[model samples]
Target: MKLYSYFRSSSAYRVRIALNHKQIPYEYIPVHLLKDGGEQKTSAYGKINSKHEVPVLEDKNVRLSQSVAIFLYLDRANLNNPLFPKAFPDFEKCFELVELINSGIQPLQNLAVLKKLKKDFEINDEQKVQWIKDIIRNGLLAYSKKISDEGPYSMGTELTAADMFLIPQLYNAHRYEIDFTGLEKLLQIERTCLMLDSFKTAHPDIQPDSV
Candidate 1:
């Protein structure tokens, strides 16, 4: 298996956490997102994923892109530690949280989007930071409210896909200095998630590609 990844990419980070959680071994192929005008845009990588994105997982005959889809694929393939909770409400709730982070929040604050905002609108660095902070703040506040108070993990006792998604977004939150002022529940979950070996090993700073 080969994982085309960038060290600081939150989407890639989510997939890495899931892979580590599942105890799957794969070769990490670093695609430097910012060096030489983004290596992902190169023709060589285009052959792998025409969309030109990181977190492309190539295993046997299956080649997958998009972190959410890749995560679900991995979870389905390895059933030992299920990414989704086994019950009714918790299972649905896990999906809800995953959608919140994966769809609602992550896309708006992605590197490409941020770069586009600057390139297209002439948004300065300070303004870009403010933009990211505003979006993350509103999204996280809503997420904090939705998360149950019973959690050391997002969906309660078991660590689910929602936790995998949340931790990386929190890493982004800290990276861009997004104000996590009143998000106690979210912060608590993040703290707990980081203590685990899976999350620790998947952190961006410790990755081989991180500079």
Candidate 2:
């Protein structure tokens, strides 16, 4: 198995965490997203993932895209350590949390989107930074409320894939200097992730290609 990844990409970071948590061994194939005008846009990577996205997981002949889907595939296929909820409502809530981060938050302020904002709309760095801050505040404000009533994890203290989703988004939040403030539940969840070897080892700075 192999994973086509960019070291600093939050989406790729989620997949790396899942792979580490499962103790699944795979070759890391670094895909430079920002070198020589974006290698992810090159024909080589485009063939693997037509969307030209990072963190494309290849297991044998099957290729997977979308960070959440890849994590689900790994967890479901290998039950030694499931990253999903066993209960129906809990599972639903987990998916809900994933949606909050992956769909509601990540897409709006991703690097590609920010690049587009600057190139097409002439948005300055300050404006771009503020836009990311707004998204983080709006998104986490709602997530903080929903998860606060739960356990240490996003849905609870079980370390589901939702936790994988939360940490990276929080890391992105920190990049914008947005204070987490009174989001105690989220803070607790973040602390839990920090204590885990999976998340710690998979962090961007420790990655083999990290620059």
Each model's C-alpha lDDT?
0.89, 0.86
Colliding residue pairs in candidate 1 = none
- Give candidate 1's TM-score: 0.96
Tell me the tens digit of each residue's lDDT in model 2 across 63-160: 99999889778977788778778898888888898899999999999878999999999999899999999998889988887783667777765888
- Residue 151 accuracy (lDDT) in model 2: 74
Cα lDDT tens digits, model 1, 75-181, are 78888778888788777888899999888898998888999999999999899999998888898888888887897877777898999999899988888887778
Give me the runs in candidate 1 sitting further than 4 Å from their true place: none
TM-score of each: 0.96, 0.96
TM-score of 2: 0.96
Q: Which number leads on TM-score?
A: 1
Model number with the top lDDT: 1
